[model samples]
Target: MSDEACRLDVWLHRARFMRTRALAAAFVEAGRVRVTRGGVQQRVDRPGRTVRIGDELVSPSAAA
Candidate 1:
């Protein structure tokens, strides 16, 4: 990975998505998080999705 490449898990955790790395990985495995760029969606499997600043990230909506 390059220095500019930020892992999805790391970004999620840093951005305060999940409490831990394991949780972030779990969310990805469950197909809850969607990483999108250029108007296309990509499912993230690991922490190596290479996220950049201001990238769109969509997760499953919370239950009411």
Candidate 2:
């Protein structure tokens, strides 16, 4: 992926959602993550999925 786009797992870590990339990947694999762009939302089940700026990501509750 280009610099403008990053792996979903990496983004999750950078955005402080998950403590580590591995955790992010696991969360995604569990189908607990969703991504929205241009008013369309899609479940992200792959950690390697490309994510870009302005893309909205929905992750499971961190407290749980």
Pick out the ten consecutive residues of candidate 2 with the lowest summed lDDT. 55-64
Instruction: Give lDDT for model 1.
Output: 0.77
Local error of candidate 1 at residue 38 (angstroms): 0.9
Give the alpha carbon lDDT tens digit for every residue of 1-64 in model 1. 6666688887788778789988877777777778888889887766567887667888777451
Alpha-carbon RMSD, candidate 2: 1.3
Candidate 2 Cα errors over 4 Å, as ranges = none
Error of 2 at 11 (Å): 0.8
TM-score, every prediction: 0.75, 0.85
Error of 2 at 63 (Å): 3.6
TM-score of 2: 0.85
Q: Write the per-residue lDDT of candidate 2 for residues 13-46, one digit (tens) a residue.
A: 8888889999989989989989999999999899
For model 2, what is the alpha-carbon lDDT of residue 11?
88
Output the lDDT of residue 61, model 1: 73
